[model samples]
Target chain A: MNFDNMRFSKEHEWVEFEKSSEVVTIGITDFAAGELGDIVFVELPEVGREVKNKEPVGAIEAVKTVADLFAPLSGVVKEVNTQLEDNPGLVNQSPYKEGWFLRLQMTDRSELDELMSHDDYSRITGTE
Target chain B: MSEPKKTPLYDVHQSLGGKMVEFAGFLMPVAYGSIIDEHNAVRERVGVFDVSHMGQFVVTGTDAREFVNRMITNDCSKLLPGNLQYTVMCREDGTVVDDLLVYVISEDRIILVVNAANIEKDYEHLTSRKRKNVEVSDVSEEYALVAVQGPRTREVIAACPFFGQVADRLQKLPYYNGITFYHRGAEVLVSRTGYTGELGFEVFVPAELAVALWDQIVVAGEDCGLAVIGLGARDTLRFEAAYCLYGHELDDHTSPLEAGLSWVVKLKKPSFCGAEALRKEKAKGSKRVLIGLAVSGRNIARQGYTVLRDGREVGRVTSGAFAPTLHKSLCMALVDRACSAGDGQFAVWVRDKEVPAKPTSLPFYKSRAK
Candidate 1:
């Protein structure tokens, strides 16, 4: 998937915005998935719940450790990927596409400015 | 902080892409590539582990057998020359000091393999009780331990020419037995015992020759799909077999009987350290007992999680994980004996919520080997 327009948080979450609908799709970055190893379970946020920027929305558990998933921006959770309930390995197999965690209706459009761009994210993650 | 110690196989682990972590005051590999994959490799094929961080003590002298027998819970008098016995040493209060393996090399000479974290403490405990004509020496720094485990373990070792004449003896070695052989003019002890619940072998080699032996075994077993496993998979493998880890299952405060290791405790032995207390506890019964739990969800119930019965905290989890081979989240907890006697219904607090769990039999997974 092209990460050209997607913005990334330092915690390794990516937010792809749809300007026409004021909605954004969020998921963990490839680097995050690689470091996490095999994902056995993912606890996603409930749809329609309010979320604030940088707040923990859910958790992702691997065989060895557990890591929290943080919201990239302030919004109302519009949808959660229910497929993860039975198949959490999707997060490790395809973190950018099929493994997208949730969709949020953006409450503050300016929050995207605070996130890093594709080039910046890649540089920070040392994935370039 | 001072730098952690490194094993002789440290360079080999790094070159194999093992992710190193600090454990028991040593820089050790937690995983090579993926823990699940490494776990499967051991179950289906064969795998090698660098467990050199474990401590070894050599006890010898005229009174060695009698002295050693009195120190542990198991009957050392029953062990033959090549026999290896799993036993626990306890405080006078019946609580465990550490669980260790005793290799009965001879009537006068014995080797005790102990946990890395408890080396100094265990050595001190052994030396504190002065015995007539007994000599105890800590030989941990002089040796390295490599565990080659799985159904295909014998084939892998036999293929390696570096093992020399001992490679042939590996085929005839029975479980819980060992033999000392010469490797590079140094004495190496090969034992048919493992923690992974598989037909396996643990080789004790001189620290200087450890790297060479590891490389040759890896090369010999390459075609048979032997991967270099780390401590992460090692823990899961042992947990599936319901093996007790030192700090988690058995501790300085927890009795071995409560840890479901009563079979190792011998009450008829005239007298031993903690025997009187253990006998009393046996007669009165224990208040808390270790039981296995199967959580209803994928979220793991980690160590220190509170176990609840009827909305009240009854116990705490000691070790828990998502068992990769079993395809379920399993945990071992020390709960109130009364709570464990019910219809197997209980709950474990994960994060903030109480996840529904049920008591299951110990050893969530059993190996196919005889």
Candidate 2:
């Protein structure tokens, strides 16, 4: 996937911002998806819930283990991908796009500036 | 602790994109691809598991049959030659040492397949309790075990060219039975036994030819949708079948009676290790019992999760998972017998929240193994 427009978090989440808007889309990166393995269920934060930066907002249930889904940015959970409720496999199949976890209305846009660029993210993931 | 051991197929697994993890003092594959995919492959078509990490022992002597019959909880006399029986060895106090498969080769010879983690413990236990006429030898490193399991296991086994004429014998082999076949001038034992609740077969081949046999089976089962399974799926499959894993359900502190393995405890046998304790427990009834839980939702009630009744801690989850075949979250818990009374509703502490759960029948997914 072309991740040029996305900002990556150290926690392996990706955030895409809407041009000139405070709204941003967040999802786990491909590396995280591969590590999670066969996601059976996704517990997304409820809409309108306040989320803190780097705090666990929900959980991702895999076949053998469970992983916490951390909030990449501080915001109100504007929307959650309801599609994940019934089909969590999408997170593994399309980690970057359709697998997006939540739409956040950012309370602090400065958090996005602290996120890593595509190159930095790749370096951390050792994909570079 | 000593460094973990590696199996003959370690390199092959790495080449196949397997995710390796340390399990029971061995570097084993946890998943080749997706664990769910591997799990479904076994339930629907066929799947192969490298169970080489499991420990194997050979017992032979004039009194081997009599000796073994007195060691385990199952009535080994009922197991005819070429048959296998699932049983547990316990301490004199009735606490489990390990759960194993006893393969009856003959009246005076037997093969004991034990858990990988309990190799040394089981070996020592058997030898310490041995009689002068019986001999016990650990042959764990001599064989590579592969389990081909699922509804399509028969077709896949028949397609393997390496089996040659033995494939025909394996095809007709009844469940819980094994056959000794000659391959490359060595004795190869194929048994119709598996932990998965499915029609399956476990083949024990010489260690040196493990990779070759694995390759042949892969090629042979290419069109049958056979995937290379790993320990992750193996545990899930066994959990769905309600099979007791050594450290999970059956442990050093757990009794077979409390583990819901009373069927294997042949108290009728005059004397055996743990016979007295088991008989006493059977008479007084067990303090706690293993029960299946139909967890309400996605949040898995993992091992160590507290099972509560009316906000009181009753027991803990032994094993839990999202069963692929049943498409629901299920768990096996050892709860106080009082929890079974009145309404079936209970709660499982999944982290901070108490997820609603209720007692359910075991073998969560009815096994098709028979």
Candidate 3:
């Protein structure tokens, strides 16, 4: 399920921006996290790292395989989810909340206009 | 979603929240919930897996017995019609093509189940060497493979509606044996074989009835505490069983003798593929031996991580993981013949750190092997 506050990307990542601040949070959608299965390690980008839109910024390692997390918007990393170093499953446990991968200071707000809304994400997923 | 390809229990897996992944061009469940949870589920209780991606082949004709005996490492001549054997398809240098389960269905017919990734390679390899009358045909896409495994798995099979009579007959079935049976209005072919160390059954049925049959078994075994397992659990369980995972443990470049599978080579089984190479290797002794590693701490040594002796690379970890049963790190690797037994453990160059590890006996995790 997608939310109005959450923007979806074709690569299955989601971004949520606070209404008043330019700071935005990113995480994989529940669908992507579920598909990855039992993340054993989470490699987070360092704070102040510049990330390009749709480019790999970090990685998630599952028991069976490994997947890199992509930045949905061009931004400077403001904060990294440090709790993930020991407990990577937080991404699978609450992907939209505490499971957030990074907080970024958005450099391009215009990128949000190109993202898919809840309905488009639902269609892309082909299910609720 | 547009009918790309469906495993026998694809629908069932979806309904149960299986997270599907693209594997070898087939849509298969990587896990249902948490891989660790699913992994533990199969180790502790009865679990079902949709292994329908495995390729099955049919070989039949007048020279079937002789052809199969000369093709694989196992002694096919001694295999009763209904019996099965775990064997390997090898190369000229004693390298294993694939480890497979071969079953003699009748005097003139036999079946070989192979890895999905090696279907074409195995088919082409087998066909290149023609026998007098034995015709080899690929029947992989036509059959659905389902595995029900764990300690309590026997109870589930015993209670399934159509398999009761056959289950009775199967009760006496020893390891590496198989039989064709009727189950739930379907022609069910079952083998007493499994990758997991737990007692289990692998069934092959027509693709058309795969989903329904899987559902019937699940619905029937509900009272027996059966959980629909996934590939995640299937892998972890097998890894814990110390089973040699293809691609990781054995490959075209690695020989059976080096992979610690010399026992299955049936070196005495006259004139099979790579028999000469294997005999030669046996005489010379192996230069590298595949061994098990145990990490004393919680840190895991993953594949591609280099094994170290005094900070120098000695070998590389081929496969490593947190074994659910052992609750510790277990790994398999090919190490140099000169390396002495690790004094209980050693170090692995994992990422930027030298992870502490120990050399454990074969099969880092042990279950019902006997």
Q: TM-score of the second chain in each model? A: 0.98, 0.98, 0.94
Report lDDT (CA) for all predictions. Answer: 0.91, 0.91, 0.81
Per-residue lDDT of model 1, residues A43-101, tens digit only:
99999999999999899998878899899999999999999998898988889889999
Top-scoring candidate (DockQ): 2
DockQ of 1: 0.85
Query: What are the per-residue Cα lDDT tens digits for candidate 3 across B301-362?
Result: 77878887666667888888877677677888887766734543467876556887777788
Q: Which stretches in model 3 have alpha-carbon errors above 4 Å?
A: A1-35, A41-60, A66-91, A95-128, B1-5, B183-186, B296-299, B339-345
Clashes of each: 0, 0, 2
Q: What range of 10 consecutive residues in model 3 chain B has the weakest lDDT sum? A: B337-346
Q: Name the regions of candidate 1 deviating beyond 4 angstroms.
A: A19-21, A118-128
Candidate scoring better on DockQ of 1 and 3: 1
- Chain A of candidate 3 gets a TM-score of 0.94
TM-score of chain A of each: 0.97, 0.96, 0.94
TM-score for candidate 2: 0.97
Evaluate residue B333 in candidate 3 and report its C-alpha lDDT on the 0 to 100 scale. 86
**Against the true structure, what is model 2's DockQ?**
0.85
